[model samples]
Target chain A: MKIETLFIDRAIRPCEEIDYIIQSTSLEPEYVENSKVVYDHVNLSDDPITKGKQTLYITENHGAVIKKCPGTSHYTCCDYTILHTGTFCTMDCSYCILQAYFHPPLLQYFVGQHKIDAALDEIFKENKTFRVGTGEFTDSLIWDKISNQPAKLVRKFADQARARSRSSNNNFSILELKTKTVNIDSLKDIDHNRKTVVAWSLNTPKVIKSEERGTASLSARLKAAKECERWGYRVAFHFDPIVIYQGCEEDYKEVIKSIFEGVRVDKNVDSSSDGVIKQSLGILPESIVWISIGTFRFMPQLKQIIENRFPKSTIAYGEFITGLDNKMRYFKPLRIKIYQKIVSFIRQYAPDVLIYFCMEDEEVWQKTIGFFPKKEGQLGAMLDRSVMERCKAC
Target chain B: MLNLQTTISNSALLKKRVKQVCLDAIDLSDESFKISSDNLFFSGNKSSSDNSLSNLTNLSNLALSIRLTGLINPIVLREIDDKYIVVSGFKRVSAMRSIGMRETPASILSHLDFDKDKTYDFRFYEVQSALIAISDNAFSRQLNVMEQARGVRLLKRFCSSYDIAQNSPAIFNVNMGESLINMLDDIANMPLSLHELIESDKLSMSSALKFKQYGYDKSLIESFATLFSKIKCSLSKQKEIITNIHEIAAREEISASDLIESKEISQILDSQSDNCSSNVNDENQKANLIRSILFNRRYPNLFKAKERFSNNLKMLNLNSGMKSDIKLDPPADFEGRDYTITLKFSTVEELAKKANILSALTKNPLFGDITD
Candidate 1:
C-alpha cells in the first residue's frame, strides 16, 4: 500500500509521528505529498469530523469498566458497547449520524493509547470483571486496513494483564474488536479468551444492502463471525439500525433464518426438551445464533441534521414522531411492532442464547427481554447472578 | 406502563379555539406542518433520527390541558411559500387531530429567530436540500452558552419584527422570540421542576427566569422535569436536589466518582480505608476478607438460600420462558385478587403438562398457586 498525501484537517491528524499504511494503493504523488495526517493523541476533543455520510465527535463519558450492549437502544434494536476507540466510523450508512456530527470532518483516529491505557489500568486494578470493546468510535477492525492496531492493542492488553496476574491478581477482560468489515484475518492469529467477545453489526438484508455502504456484505461478515465462533471464541451479533422499510419484516426474518443456518444452537438442551423434541440417543437439532436487535434511532438532533445534510435520503423521512428526548423521528407503535417481530424471531430460533436490545429503557427491556432489572445495570448483573447461582449451587 | 384505560378524563374540559378549527383550513402545505409518523414520538429512544415527543406530546397535552382550563394559548405560526407553517404548536396540532378535529387556531408570526444584529434564513424549497449536512436520525448539537446566547439575541430581534397586540400580557409584551429563547435557555439551565412548572404553568416567569445564570446538573433538571410533567409538582431548590438524587440512584449504579464527589463522604471513606490498612500487611487482604465474608456461609444455609433464591429467580425468568405456556385469558374462579389463571390447553399432552405444574404447585408449599 502506497501512502497518499492530501491536505487533511489538523483535527484528524493527531500525533505527528505515527505509522499508517495507505489502504488505497493508487495514490498519486500529489495525493501523498500535500496530505496532512491525524491520529488520536489529545484529551477527548469536542470537534466533530463530518464526511459525506458520516460525522464523528467525541464526548467525555465515565462509564462501567464492564459495559452492557447487545445494541438495543430504546428506539433501535441492538445496543452494544464499543471501547470508544475514537468517534467516527469508516463506513457510510445513509442514515449515519456522522455526516452531521462533525464539521469539516475527517477520518480521525484517537491515538492517545496512553490515556486509554491509564483508564484501563484503573479499570483493571479494580478487577471487577469488566467486559469492554473498542468498536465505538470507529469500526473495530477497519484500523487494521491501515495497520493491525487492534491486534497490537489486544496483544498488549493480554500481555500486561498476564504479567499483573502473578502479583495483584484480578481477572480482566481484554477487548472485543467488532466490525462490519471482513477484517478478521488479522484477528485470527491473536490469542484471546472467552473474556473477549468478537461482535459484528448485522442488519436486515435490505438494510445492509441499501442503507449501509462501504461495509462488507452480510454473508462475508457472518462467515467471519461463524469462523470466530468455531475457533471457540464467544461471539456477538448486533441487528442495529433496523430500518423500517417496506419489506422489513420479511427481510429481518431472513436475517434470523440465515443466522440459525450459520450458528447452530441446540433446542432440547436449551430450557429442557418439551418445546422441541429430543431422543434418548442424545441427538439434538442445530440451533440459531445469539442475536440482539436495536430499532432505528439517532440522537435527537440527528434527524434534522440528516435532513439538513442528506435531504435526498428517504431513510430519515420515515414514519416518526417526537420521543421522550424530543428529537423528531419515529412513532412508538411502529417501533414496538418492529421490536416484537425481531424479538419473537430471535426467541424462536436461538432459544438458548442471550438476546437483548441496545440503549433501551426499562420498559422495553421488560417487554422484550422479559425481565426488568431492579435497577439499570441489573440486566448485566442478572446474567452474572444467574451463572453464579447455578455454579455455587453445585 | 401508564394504563391506557386509566387516562385522565377530559369531559369537564372546554375545547379550545385551536381544537375547534380545521387543520385543512389552517393550510398545512408548508413542509413544517406535515409531520412524518416515525417511531421517535416515544421517549428515551437514543437514535438521533427518532423525534422526541416532548414538544409534540407537551403541546398536545397542553391543548388537552388548555381545554381543561378553558383557555387557548395562541401558538406562533409562520408563512412559508404562501402556506402558514407552524414553528411551534406541533403537539397542539397532533392533540387536536387525536380528538378528530380538523383545524386549530394559531398565532401567525415570522419564522426568523436570530440575534438582533444578524439575519439569515435557511431555505427549504425541495426537501433534499434541507437534509444535506446532517445524519443521526436525531439532533446531537450541544446547546452551549454561545448557542443559547445567540438564540436569546435572535428571539429579541425577531420579536421587534412581529406585531404585538396591546391587550396581550406584559410577559408576552417583551420580545416573545427573546422570551421563548430565554425560557429555553432557562430550561437548558433550569432544574427540571422549574421546567415542568413553566411547561405546566405552575411556575411564574419571575421565578423560572432566575435559573438562566445558574445551571442545575442534568439529573436535577430531568427529575424536576419529570415531576413537573407527570405529577404536576412545583419545583423548589431542595425538591430538585432530592428528586434528582433519588432518580439518579434508581437509574445508575453507585460508582467511585459518585462516592468521591461528596467531599465529606470521601473524607470518611479515606479515613476508613486508612484505618483498615493500618492493621493489614497484604494489599488485597481486605478485599479477600470482604469477599469471603460476603460469600462464606454454612452449606446448609447456602443450600437453603440457593433454593429460595432460585425459586424466586425462576419466577422472574419464567415469565420469558413460559410466555407461550401462559394464557392471557382470566380464569372462571372469579376472584379479582386471586387472579384466576386460565390455561388454553394446546394439545392433550400440554393439558397433562398443565395439570402437572398445577399439581406440583399444590404439592410444594414453597410454590404458590400458578394462578397468582
Candidate 2:
C-alpha cells in the first residue's frame, strides 16, 4: 500500500513523477506518502472516449440497498433513488460531508455500468411508479467527464418503452443528475421526453468561492441550466445546505433573481401538471418545474464525524440546535428568514414554479409553505402521481 | 342485591336521577368519606368497597361548572347495596352536595357486582378493585411506544363493548389520538434498554405495538416495560447503542421483546390482533415512534446525569467564566483512566458540572477507583 507521487501538470517534469496534477484543494501534502494519496490527473485516460478508472475515488457500497428513505426525514426534500456514481467531486466545500462520507476521500468514479444497467432494469421492471435520482451519493452529472454521464442513463430510459407504458402513467423519470458544475454539453441532445432532470446544486457566490473549491461560478452553472431548459429538457435547481451566513438574504436574492433572468419560468411552467407558480418568466410547457431550498442540516453526531474525518471544514460551524428528530437544527428564526426571503423573491419572478424545501420539519414546512403536506411522502409523491395521472388520462 | 344491569341501557333515566341529586340544595358537610381526595378525584378507579369507609372527599371548589352551566353532562351509575353508584356526578347534583347537605337525594340503583355470589361482601369488591387496577403507580410512569400501544389496545378492547354512548370507532378514534400522543412521549421517554430493541432488529414497531397491546397483563408487562425502559434510557445514556430508527427498533427487540416475548409467546401473538382500528392516530403513533428514534439520538442517561451534575455544580458559587479551568478528580471505582482524560463535554456547563461533581466525591468509597 505504498503511495506514489507524480506531478501531472500539462508539461512533463523530469524531477517529479506524479500521478495527478492536484487541482483545487488545500489537501496536498508536501511529500505525499500514503496509500490513500489521490492521483489528480486532469486527464487520467489517454483516450477520452474509452472509459478509464475514473480519477473519482469510488468504493462499492455493498451495504444494504434498501435504506430507510432519508426522504422520510422532514428536513429531507429530495427523494433519493440510487447512487450510481460514488464520491467524485472536484469541489472541496468545507461543510461537504462527502469528505468523510467516503473513506480515502479521493475523487474516484466506479465504472460499474454492467451492475448499474442490471440494477436499473430491475428497478424499472419492478416499480410501476417510482421517483428515483442518482445524485444521492455523488453529483449525478459530475462524472460526465469520465463516463457517458446521464446520457447513457437517458438512452437506457428511452429503451424502456414497455416499462414506461406499463407504468399506467408517464410519472417515471430515470436520473435527476444534480450538479453544481456547468457541464451540460453531454446532455444537450437527449430525447426531451426521456425523464432526465438536469438539476443544479446552486449556492451563494460567497459560499461557492470560499467553501466550494474547483466548482463553476454561480452564473456559469445557471447559464448551463438555462441552456438545458432551452434544449427542451426540464430542469431543477437545489439550494441545498444553503449556508445561513450574514447577508445570505442578498446572496440568495441574487441567485433567485439570476435564475429567473436566465431560465424562462413562465413558458416552462405553463404546461406543468402541478400548476406550480413560475418564479421566472417565459419558458416551454413543462411539468412541475421548481426549486428545492433548504438550509444546512445533518445529524448532530455527524458534526463530530465530520470534524474527525474532514477536520478543516468551516461550514459545520454555524449555530445549530437539536431539531425534533434530534438532529442538529439550524436556528429556526434564521432558517425561516432565509426561506421567507428566498420564497418571496422566487414568488416575485418565477411565481408559478413549484418551490419546496427538503428535509425540513412540519413546523418549518407550514411556515415556508402555507400548509403542511398531509402525509410524509405525499408532497414528493403527489407531484409525480398527478403528473402520471394527467399523462394517463391523455 | 337490586339488579341494575337491566337498566344499564336506560342512560337517560340515570342522567335524570343524577341531575336531581346534584341539583338538590344542601349545606356542605365536613370529612364525609374516609378515602383521600387525591384518590377519588384523579385515581381512575371504577368501584370501591361498601364497608371500607374511604374518607374520599368530593371536589368542593365549585363555581359554575362548565358542563352543567352549558348543558347536562351524562352520569355513569354503578349499582351498590340496592343503590346506584354515580361513577361521575351530574354537575347540578354535585353542586347541591357541595352547598352542605348530608345525603342530598340520590338516584338509588344497585352497584355493579360482576360477581353476584359475593354480593354485600366488601372484600370481594376490594379484591375486584385490586384486580382491575390497570397500572402500578410504583413502576415507571411513562410508557414507550410499545408499552403505550399495548395499554391503549387493552383499554380499547376493555371499553369497546362498554355501555358508553359512543360506538367503537368513535371511542377508538379518541383513544387512538391519545395513544398517538403518548407514542411520541414513549420515544422521548424510552429507556436505553429498550433502545436496543429499537436500534437493532430485535424489536419492530409492529411488534413493539404488540407488546403495548399485551401490557394489560400488568405484572408481566410492567416488569418487562421497566426493564426495557431502563435498557433504552441506559443505552442512550451510555452512548453504547445505535440511535438510528431501524437500529433502535432492532436492538429493542433483542433486549426487550425477543427474550421476553419467547417466554410470553401466547400473549405476544394474542396482542397482535388485526381487529384493532388502523386509524390516523394509531398510524401516526407508530410513525412517530420510528420517526423520533430515527431523527433523535437516544442517549437516555446522558441528559439525566448531566442535569444531576449541573444541579450539583450550581451549589458552588463559581462564576461562569471560571467554569472551564476547574478539574475533576476521578472516583476510585471508575474504570478507565483514559476515559477521565478523553471525555469531551458537549458544552462548557457540562464540563464545569462534571468537574465539580467529580471533585466533590472525594469522601466517597468509589472515589479512589475513579478513572484518569
Candidate 3:
C-alpha cells in the first residue's frame, strides 16, 4: 500500500495510534475535524477512487464496531459478523462495491480499540458460535503498510480463544483476517492460539490484472498464506467477485490449481521454492479451514459508478438479470455452469476442504454443490462447525 | 416577504446586467458600412461556433414576408479580413438567400470605431458577437436544447467550465455540470441529420448521443431521422432501439451501419411503407414492431425464456367455460418462482364453484407445472 497523504481526526489526535501512523509515514499529518473534510479533499481530485487510496484518514471509529454483513437476508448469507475496523480500501478494483458503497470513498481506518474490544467481549461471552472477520469492508492487511493493526486484533482473538478453550460445548469464535496483500510479518510469532483464520481473496490472473488494481499477485498471496499456515495459523481463501469472461473457466481452474499447489501439498517443500522445488517441509492442506465462493454481483447503481470511474471495464456488460435480491447477477444457468466448473476444480486438489458460497441462493447451492443449506440457519451452523473442528479453542 | 423581495431584486438586477452596450451601431443609411450578399462567413475561424444549427424552420413564411414587406429587419454583420461574418439575424439572412435575393440592407460592426477594440481582446469580441447572435434569437422565442447547447459551446471559448457552472442556469436556463457540459459539447458537434431529428422533437438528446458514440455513418443516422420524422417514439424508446442494435451489431461482429442496412431492419421499414405510406395509425405500430425486433435480437436468452414461459402458459387453455373466473400470471421474465393466482368470485356460491373448479384444475396434468 502507498501512503502519500495522512489525515488525523481531531477526535483521535491525542491517541497513541496517531503517533504510530506519524512515525510510519514521512508525510506531515493534516488534522481535520471530521471525515467529511478528507472526503471533500479526495472528491476534488481528478479521480476520487484512485486519489482516495493514496490519502489515508486516521479517524475515530464512532459507528458500530461490529455488525452483520450487508448481504441482505433475502440472499443466502454465511451469517458472518463484520469487525468494522474501517470503511474503505487502498486497492482500486473495477467491480468494487466500496466505490459506490461509500458516499465519496476514502481510505478511512478507525483508531482506538475499546469499542471493538467491548463488542468482541460480548460475542465471546455468548454460548453460541460466531464467525467474525475484519476484511468485510477493508482488506485486513492493508494497514500493515503503516500500522500493526491486524496483529493487535490477532492478540485479542487469540487471548479470548485461549481463555475459552476449556468449554466442552462446540461454542467458539473465529476471527478471519482476510486480505489481498503480503503484509504478514507482524502476524508471525503472535501467540494466535490457532483461532485466527488468515485468509486471502483469490481471483484469476486476468481479473487481477484488468480489474483488481494494486492488489497482491496470485502467487504472492498464496505464498503469504503458506507462511501464515507455517506460523500455526489456519488459512482460508475466498474466490469472490469471480469475474466471468472468455476462457475464465480455464483461468479460474488454474487459480484453484495454483492455490493448492502453492500451499496444500503433503506438508513438504523447500522454504524458498518457486513452487516446483520441494524438500521435507511444506504447508499442509489441513491448514486450510474453509474456502468461500461467490460470483460477481453488484447493486444496479454500481454499474454506472464503474462505468464512470473505469470506462475501460467491461465487467458490468454480462448476460445479467436482476436477481431476487435486486442486485445484477449472471443469468441463473450461466452462474450454475461456472460455479460447477470452479467447484469441481477446487475439489480436485483439496476434496475435504470446507467450501461454501457467500451469498448464493438455495437453488444455486442445490444446482452447483448438490445441496442446499437453507433450512433452520443451516449455512451458519455448517460454517460454525468448520470453525470448531479446525480451531482448538472449541 | 424576504423571498419575494429577493426574487424581484434578482430579476431587476439580471435585466440591468444583461443590457449589453458594446455595439458600435452603423447607420443603415450609409451603404459603405453595409456588406453585400457575396461576403463570406464562417463561425470565426471555428474557434467560436453557432453549432447544433439546422435549416431555419418556416423559411417559406419568412421568405413570403420578405417578398411582401421587403426585409423590415435589417441583418447585422461583423467585418473579417475584407469579408463579413454574420453577428445576428442568421435566420433572416438565410431566408433572404433562400429566396435568391442578390443584395440586402445590413449594418456592420464598427470595427473602425476602436472604442470596442481598445484592449484588442479578440476573444472578447468573438464572444460578444456570439452572445449577441444567441440573445437575438432567444429574446423572440425560447431556444431549444440544441440552441442552448450551441450557445454554451460558443461561450466556452471565453468562459471556463466554472463560469458555465455558475452562470448557465441564468443565461441558458440549463443546469451545467462537467458531464452535462461534455455531453452538450458532443451534442453541439453532432452531424446535421441527428441535430435535425432532435430539434424536430422526432429523436431525443439521449438518442443523439447514442448515435454519435456508435460513430454510425450519415446514411444510417439519416435513416433514423427520416424514420422518426414520420413515426414518433419517446426518447427512451429511441435510445433503447439504438442501444439494442448497437449491441447486436457488436455481437454479430458487424458495424452498426451494416446492421441498420441489414434486411431485418430494412424489411421492417419496407413492410411499414408497403402497408400504407401515409397512414398516421401505422406510425406507432411500425415503431413498436421495430423496437420489438431489435429487442428480441439483442436479448436472445431472455427472449427465449419469455417464449417458453408463454408457450407453457398457453397450455393451460384457460379460455375454457367457467374457468373465466380464474386468472394466472407468471413471474415477470421467468426470473422468479412466484406465481400469482386470482379468482373472481363475489359470493359463497361462487366461491364454492371456484373451489370445485380449482379442485378439478389441480387434477389437470398441466396444472403442476403452469409456472414454467
Candidate 4:
C-alpha cells in the first residue's frame, strides 16, 4: 500500500524501520499522542473509509502481537494462528468484512520488529504444530515496499533455531503471506527454505475489475504465484469472498481452469491428458500446497457501509439470511450449489491439491466434497498435516 | 453577546401598552416564526399533510378559544419598518385573520429580535429568534423529526454541531448524535417532498442519506416519499424497501424512478387505495406483496427454494400449536446441519410418551425433506 500520508504515534520511539516507511512512501511524518488525533483527522474528511486507506498509521501494538484466528462459532475453523501484524488493508472490495470489522476502518501498520520477533519466539519455542498466516486481518504483501516483514519472516522461519531455550525440529510452523497484490520482488532472492508459502487470493477478472479496486489483476496474481514458486517458496491460492452473480459460476470455472494451467501439478500424478488438463506436468516442479474456497459472507452492519461506499456494487443484494453464527450468508442451497461446482472444477484438474473450505460446516462439506473434515480429522489437524507434509516442517 | 431573552424582558418593549394592529401589515410569508419547513407536502399525500406550512392549522379550536374569552396570550411580534412579523404566535394571527378579526392584542417589539433592516447583530438575532420559535412548539408538544431537523438547520449557522448535539433535546425535543448533524442538515437542504416523508415518518434518516448519496434525480426521491407516505411503513421497513428497489434497479440497468413508478407497482399500490374499486384494504398486505415481488425479481430460484421449504415444513404435523407437544426447528436460515427438537412435558411419563412420538417421527421422510 502506497500511503499518501504517514501518521506516527508520538510515544513510539523513532527507529530506522519507521524512517524507511516514511521515506519509501515519500510522506512526511505527523506524530500524534494517540488514536484520537487520527480519528478526528479522518472524521473531518467527507469519506472516512476511503481517506483511511490513503493515510497509514504507524503505531505500536500494545496487545498480543500474535493471536489465534477469530473463527466464528458453529463454523469449521482451520485452527490457523494469526500474526497480528496489522489491522486493515488498502484494497477496496465491496465484500470486505474489514470495513465493518474495524470501527471507522483505518490502515494500521504495527511497526516493531522486536515485538514481532518476540511473538514469534513463543511459537518457535513451543513444541507444537502451527499453520500461521498474516492474511487474517490484512493483506500480507500490501506493504512489501514500506516493510520487509514477510521476507524477514521467511528468514526467521528458515533459521528454526534462532529463538529457543529448547531446540526441536518437532515444532513445525509455516509462514503464509497471502495477498491480492503482486508485490513479490523483495521475496525473490530470499532463501525461503520451503518455510514460507506465498499465496494469492484468486477472483475472476470481471470481479477484479469491478469490485476489487486497486488490486492486481487475476493474471498478474497468478504470474506472481508462479514467480514465488520459481523462487523455491511453496504457494497457495484462496478463492475467498467469492461473490455470486448471474454468470459467476462460469466465471469461477474459467478461474479454476487458469490456476491449474498456470501452476504446475503434483509430480506423482499420472501425466494424464484430459484435453483440458493436458498441460506439461512432467518437467515442472509441483508448487501448490493447498487451495481454500469460501463464498462471500459478511456481518450485517457491513450492508449499510457497502451500500453507501460502493453504491454501484450489487454484491450485498444476494439471497442472504442470518446464519447460526449471526453473519449474513448466502442461502444454504445457493452456497452448496456453487461450492459443488468449484470443488468439482478443481478436482478435475489437480486431484492431489488438498482442497478445503475456509469456514463452511459439516453438512456443506458432505454435499460439496463428499467428506467432512471432522470425519477425517479436525479441519486444523488436516491442514497441519497437509502443510507439514508439503513444506517438510516439523 | 447580549442575552436575547433578558434583553427582551428588561427592555421597555413588553412594558409598553399592548395595541391592536392591522393583520395586513404583517409579512406572513416570512418564515421567521416557523422551525418547520413550509413546503414539505408531497403531492399525493395531502390527506396526512397536517403540517403543510399552513400557519392556519387547528384554526377553529383557536378561534373557539378566542371567541369564548379573548386573546388571553397576546401574540408576540416585532416591527419591520412599515410591516410586522409574528415572532412566536403564528397560529394565533392566522386564526384571527381567518375569523375576520383583522387585528388582535399584540406585543410589538420595537427592539426586534428579527429585524427587517440588516444590522451587524442581524445574524445573531436570527439565531436567537430561530431558537425561540423552536422552543415555543417543542415545549408544548414533541416536535416531529423534520421540525427538529429544520431546527438543527437553523441553529447550525451560529454554533458547532457538537454544541447542537449536546443541547438538542431542549431545543428540538429529540436527542441527536453529533454524527447525525449531517442528516439534519440534509433535512433542511433536501427538497420539500423528501422533508414531508421524514416529517410524516415515511422515510428515515439513514434512507434519506442513502438517497442523498445516490445523487439521483429528485423524482426518484419524490416517488419513494409518495409511496412510503401512502403505505406508512416503519423506519426499518422503509430502509429495506428502498435498498431492495435500488439494488434491483441497479442490477437491471433501469432508472430507479422508472422502476418505482412502473405500472405494476402502481397497480399494486392503487389496489389498497380508497378510490380504487379493489377490495384490498390492508396496506401491510400490499407491502408484503411488494416485498415478494422484489424477492422474486431478485432471486427466482431462492424464492422457489423458500416455497419448497415452506411446503415441506407444512407436511410435518408434529408442531406444538396443533395437539402435539413437540417443537421442531431447523437451524437458523437453514444454513447448518443440526435440527432441534424441543419436547415440553410436565411429567416423566409424558416425557417418555413425547420422546416415543419424536422417535416415531424419525421414520417420516418429509421430516428430512425440510433439510433438502
Candidate with top DockQ is 4
lDDT of the structure predicted as candidate 3: 0.72
Q: Across residues B28-112, which tens digit of lDDT does each residue of candidate 2 receive?
A: 2321111112223322222233112331233343323432453233433344343444333333345444554434334333334
DockQ of each: 0.01, 0.01, 0.24, 0.49
- Candidate order by lDDT, highest to lowest? 4, 3, 2, 1
What lDDT would each prediction earn against the true structure? 0.47, 0.48, 0.72, 0.75
- Model 2 spans > 4 angstroms off: A1-68, A71-78, A161-163, A166-170, A263-288, A300-314, A385-394, B1-372
What is each model's TM-score for chain A? 0.71, 0.73, 0.92, 0.91
What does the lDDT come to for candidate 1? 0.47
Candidate 4 has an lDDT of 0.75
Give TM per candidate.
Answer: 0.42, 0.42, 0.82, 0.85
lDDT tens digits by residue: candidate 1, B1-372: 111111112111211123234465555444332222222233332222233445556556656775676435554455456455554454555566666665566654432354673533232211111111111111323322223332333233323212212211222222334345545445444453453344334444444443332233555444334422322223353243332333233223342135223553223223344464444433234333322332222122333434554565366333554334643322221111233446667689888877776565556544443333
Indicate the TM-score of model 4: 0.85
Docking quality (DockQ) of candidate 3: 0.24
Which parts of model 1 have CA positions greater than 4 angstroms off?
Answer: A1-17, A22-82, A160-170, A263-290, A304-312, A383-394, B1-372
> In model 4, how large is the Cα lDDT of residue B129?
63
In each prediction, how many residue pairs overlap at the backbone (N, C-alpha, C within less than 3 A)?
A: 131, 122, 5, 1
